[model samples]
Target: MANPDHEGDVGPQVAQREQRLSGLPQQVLYGVAYYAEYQPYDRLERDLDLMAAAELTVIRVGESVWSTWEPEDGRFELEWLHPVLDGAHARGIKVILGTPTYAMPPWLVRKYPEVTAERKTGVRIPYGHRQDGDYSNAAFRHYADRITRKVAGRYAPHPAVIGFQVDNEPGMELFHNRAAFQGFVDRLRHTYDDDPQRLNREWGLVYWSHRIARWDELWPPDGNTVPSYDLAWRRYQSQLTTDFIAAQAEIVRELARPDQFVTTCMALKRPAFDPRELNRSLDIAAVNPYYPMQDALTMPEPPPDAPQLEWETHSGVWAIHYQADLARAALRQPFLVTETNALSIGASHGNFPAFDGQWRQAAWALVARGARMIEYWHWHSIHYGHEQFWLGVLNHDGEPGRAYAEVQRIAAEFKQAGAAVVGLEPTADVALLYSRESKWAMEFHPPLATAAGAADRSSYERIFSRFYEGLFTAGVQTEILFAQDFDGTEHPVLIVPGLYVADDALLDRLAAYAHDGGHLVLSFRGGYADHEARPRTTKQPGRLFEAVGATYDEYTNLTAPVRCSGDFTGAATAWADALQPTTAETLAYYEHPHLGRWPAITTHEHGKGRVTYVGTLPDRELAVGLARWLRPNPDVFADRPKTVTVTSGRAPEGGLVRFVANWSWEQARLALPVAMTDVLNGTDLAFGEELHLGAWDVRVLLERPRKKDDEEGRPLA
Candidate 1:
């Protein structure tokens, strides 16, 4: 087995070099996952021909079956994929070859039983599932490296192969194997500078008589009760995942061509993942964003009390944009949608495919938010597997269906638009701060409770999503900023919610940002704790008290909604802070007998700017009101109907590209604010003319360059 840190005789330094792919193709790439091997019969030629007819440009292949790639240890079967690649090349379709490392072969697992991952210290997870091994184990790494080199070496030179997906959705589980635990301990030792006392003090180990006198005194995270310890464990697990992907990417890069890229599919909500850290090592970021279809995509969405579906897919249309924005934020560049919905997407019982025209709507939405490629999860539905019911473009009978027709229309549109809309730089009026550390900490010590009174582990996401949804509802575009990457002046407004695990430097920076004329909107639990998940001894909202002009020493969990009055109307739910404002002015107050004494929202002038503090989890009405107040400036698409949404971005050729959609069954019309050419229809429309939109339809319009006389302040005819 090779040393995990070493790269052959070249050592660690050379292996650590970053080899990211710089640019992608100028046009939007559209296709699906083509599994010729998984087909019931030999249909490689026919599949390629159909893909060509659909105007598909690329197909991802060979990312799932490991046993087929290597039936026995040290044995390789590399010729089976040749026909598929050759057929695709003949049809002018490109390919993204995948390394089958995520799925371990049965023979390898049987030969090396110790490589199996343990859910707990000694409880090995049962086999017959994907990603069930401790990939950090030396034995597993040896075989993984061998197979990756063989497959990539064989196909890297293929004419149709354009890139490589290193692993399929890496970081699904947190391994608790002996080697993994030892690595965690070693990480702690280095982090604390080999000082046991420092680790003890930082982790607050004196509580419950848990102080460690030596490094070895640390117990496995399985039985840990401390929040700080759990935070450290989660961070270390994410680091392990990043390391694994980085190593595999390094292997593929060595075998790949200069034109071929290397990346792994990212499921953003995976437990043991950090996208920003992981993407630093890859060429381009890729994500699988699956969303609920049908009425779930409709605007003026179901009421708050509506019965929600229990699934892994995102719930609302705003959530879909949220996922795409997050993917762009990963490396601050355009990314790929490796796998999204084709037909139905989940278990055998779950089958709700998109309504007519929804595929086009979703594809345009993703592109508007910076997607370079749009690929479905698969081309044809599988005949047998755990995902057999996860339907595709061509269903079980292998005939082109509704999904295929919709995808084909989208592909032709992408071809027509060409380089005009690809690689767009999305516009943002507000910057929202995102913290992975804070999310991990809140998962362990949640501040909110479910309706059943159970601790809500998703407390961070709930708070963040409310503000994001409010911005989307109020027609304010947002840019997501990671805490470490946030500077003072990214946008006019910076909204931070439930940032409970920030260090002193970050808190101070937020204060400075407000002082430097940035409108800072803060919510409950911001600046409450240090990076170690230790509560600050200073007043609640520790470092921002001066900038905010308000402080809270007490808070409560509400059993019911509390009405809010003053500027913002609606109710506050789940939690509230008893804010004591010294220099701040009250913006809203809670309509309660006892809680009414403290303001529900307040604002204070500090330096050149102001800070508005929200003391409770706001209902949707209040959230939209607050968003409107924060970004009061009106744009061309302001005051549109509830069913109509318009998102604009800077195109690659330095022109404004706007995506106007009516997310409803009723036709809608929007009066143009500027002269623009419809990219899809090739029609020019004058300013103030009403543009018609069909139900569930989206139109891409490019703003025309102003005439010299118009630029000199003369009115255009």
Candidate 2:
């Protein structure tokens, strides 16, 4: 039975119209996930009208509904999606079709019981929710390939389709199936050359009488006390997820048009796997930033007389900036926020919805940091679903609210200042090193509370975030560099935090970096273990001890805040270590009765540069002070107030776009670096003039727009 509305086929007129629409390049795209199948009302056209009114240029659909796409095995129902594409295209909106592999259909699962991922307890997870399918399962891969090809083939020729999201948050579930265990064994055999002795020796398996005699003698990593095997298991899981997404991307590429792209939404916060590896096969990096905006990155309170003092307060820009910067660093390019909040309700406990103008501030902050697109998680709230309470811009009643008003205002600004917001690259002189190896290693052997006297639960991300927050508060532009991506020659200042999993190669690189006139700041737990999480056999503090000129043979985890006073005065928490400086100078010491005179912070000069090793998790005040001491303000803004953060990028026109954002609730009056026009409001200002900003306000300034023929008009590589 052929559908009559198509008139034999989607004619050339529709194709030509879509091509014309595609010819006009947009500075940035904005929209939401349009789930027509899940909507209780039959008003998709009306919803499209609302989206058009809000200047939404894109809509993502058909990602999480596999049963609806194919009700039965080998029978696909793709016709239902035609209207969605047609409706969005009719309103000048492009669509991104998704491969429905994240969710599985009951018929397929009933036929292939092994397709589901098994929990670490060897119990197969029932398929009531998403991400239950096993990535390593052959049957799951077969169906994933079939369904991906079918959807991609059907939509590849559709002119309205702009891209394809391969899968929704892959690696969110950790699979411990039989296949994964065998895969782990194969990996171990390949790494150790089938030598059980080498594996046992490297992993220190002789302890606890856990030595393996043969390859088969090795069991799953469940309940394993050895860190090497545990680290290997995590690496294998990451590989599985990477391979799964790569397979679908390959399939989509084969069927997608040249203009179309293939990518996946990366969940960096979930900590299930590394997003860097998963993004290898993607076109552009897309991150989901549903951070606890109100409380994640704590900042000091404003003065009593500050503007909006009675209003609520939130953290600095570090939390979202860290995530987005890492996503951009993963791809080394401008990225997209595929999913952020509109109303921000649901399963997240104690989450406060956005205050008026807060949504606009957050959106513009992302754009200021090289994000080319910002799409809300959804358009309208679903009437019935597991996430029914996750409200959108439009509630279940389908009425626009304060969130929609904010989106509309932001859309107007984005349309007006297209060149200022787009094609700009975020650059930084400082880089923070992050790695999944360290995160997994720390999770396996967290700092014991008995040593600290307090039960400290700070994870690797939390500690890293604190350091980043320090730098952010200091108004230093920063970028995140993964361990694999770190290049010693690129960044002038490098900050390494709690790098629990260390190796000689990385330590050597850091030493060379410091010797070559680069500043290095390292925290506790750094250079303490190898890549496999085994303690280094050398003197305590591991391979880089010579560069740091310090050795900490003993450590303690604090049960309460321990006072530290000297050049640096503050309280330490979570963990502290006893430091014996070799050629280093002590900057601070513990003020405790028994632990007095022990170095709490040390600094060493190597070759032409410097290295600072913090022996304790310093408080926020000291953390901020350290960041400021490392990288002082540039000469252009040496006297700029600390309350205001300034980020600069090359404008599409041959000039710079400066984003001056006031992160505090109080008004910030800062001197302008140059005479410029505020692009956001078209106000011209003189150099050295004082500029005042209200609480949570952002100003985009353009520095003398250049002509199109100017050589510098081109973007920076």
Predicted model with the maximum lDDT: 1
Residue pairs with clashing backbones, model 2: 451-557, 452-557, 452-558, 452-559, 453-558, 453-559, 454-558, 454-559
Give per-residue CA lDDT, model 1, range 1-717, as digits (tens).
001211112334224322234335668999999899898898877788889999999899999988999999878899999999998889888889999988888898799988888889888888888988788889988888888999999999998998899878888888889899999999999999999999888988899999988888899988899998899999999998898889998899888887778889998878888888887777778999988888888886744542234654347778889999888888777788999999888887778888898889999999999998999988999997799989989999988989989998999999999999888988888889999989998889999999999998899999999999888988889988777666565477889988999999888888888887778999999999898899999987888988889998899999899999999998999999999999999999999999999999999998988899999999889998999889835655775788888888888679889999888999998888788899998999898789998999999998888876774323221
**C-alpha lDDT score of every prediction, in listed order:** 0.86, 0.77
RMSD (CA, Å), candidate 1 to true, equals 4.9
What is the Å distance of residue 28 in model 1 from its true position?
0.4
Q: What would you estimate as the lDDT of candidate 2?
A: 0.77
Best by TM-score: 1
Worst lDDT run of 10 residues, candidate 1, spans 1-10
